[model samples]
Target: MRWITSISYKNGDGEVALAFAPEIAQFLVQLKKHFTSYQLSKAAALRSTYSWRLFENLERFRETGIWEVDMDRFHTIMETPKSYRRNFNDARRFVIDPALAELAAKTNITAQVEPIRRGRKIDRLRFTFENASQMKLAL
Candidate 1:
């Protein structure tokens, strides 16, 4: 469950590469904990996405219960680089893993992400980027 990322120097927007696995949730937790600073890449944007181009760890969702099911409007915004994460941290706070966030700054490993939209049965998929787009770094 390794992913590559595309970081944007412009407004800090970027893309992602998706790789699904049984440990997807745990893997994403690691990413949230380690993909900060300059470790981010661009390939990650295209890995496994449709609307929500960003990555989400299922384990984190279960542990923290910070899941968002209907974020179509947000994903719509990220589809354009011009309207990426307005307040970088603000955008990721709810979607990403919290423990990883606590450690992100320590290692400078955080990927400013873009949120994707969702499909009809997206609820069934544990790890899905099928409804997201990439854009922005911060507000």
Candidate 2:
């Protein structure tokens, strides 16, 4: 579907406006929408595509405060390169670590990764995250 059908200047002060497709507008108006404008802005501000993808996924579990995924699923979700898929360190160094760090730096969310091990190999990655505002409310 066409997410946006038209765009125009709404005012003399250079304010712009968008006309979204009917289905897109209706979806946005629906209850329990997938994300907020703030989250989308934060994701857009990220430099790495990896960070953007991770931020989008993380927002889904923002309230729950944790996101866990097995190695295979993580690779699929992140869309990592062949080298990264073959080596956990490569994935962490090139994809996961930098993405997490960028998200922490650019957004109000902080995350920590815990890699679960199965014998001599990494099995899954657990991400525990928190919004700064939520943490402040708890204090």
Candidate 3:
């Protein structure tokens, strides 16, 4: 049988000892950002899940000795995704929600959002409000 192991190296344990297959390493890189070397090393030990398969024949991994299977395949099996959720609370902290509330106090008309675009060099992210006669931007 093969089982993927993610050994923790905390409180001064070689910092980072794992050497995964190239794909597995890349997958980890994508998930982590703005982390220091110490943080990255700790994050590497986190595993979403493990994958295992029992070998029918005895010679599946090695001739006779014990085997250490890389957890790449197991990571791959659990990595299939369904949907992405935007963190609305955190997003509100940064932008937009307060601005909408401010607009509500100013206008007697109802407002619907058109799409919000990312700001460029001079152009700002804009929100549009539509009443009966015309549409105006609330930027």
Best by TM-score: 2
* lDDT by residue (tens digit), candidate 2, 1-139: 6799999996768898899998888877775665434445556668998998888878888879899999999999989998898899989999989999988878878999999999989999999998777322212
Clashing pairs in 2: none
What TM-score does model 1 achieve against the real structure?
A: 0.18
Candidates 1 and 3, the one with greater TM-score? 3
lDDT of 1 by residue, 39-138 (tens): 2343233222322233233223433334454344444533523232343344344434442333232222243333343553222112322212343353
Ranked by lDDT, top first: 2, 1, 3
Give the least accurate 10-residue stretch of model 3, judged by summed lDDT.
Answer: 50-59
Report, for all candidates in order, the number of backbone clashes. 43, 0, 0
lDDT of candidates 1 onward, in order = 0.36, 0.84, 0.31
lDDT (C-alpha) at residue 105 in model 3: 39
lDDT of 3 by residue, 1-139 (tens): 2132454565765575455666577667776753223223222322222111111111122233223322233123323222211332333333334434433333222333233333522211222333223324458
C-alpha RMSD (angstroms) for model 3? 22.8
State candidate 3's TM-score. Answer: 0.19
Question: Candidate 1's C-alpha lDDT?
Answer: 0.36
**lDDT score, candidate 3:** 0.31
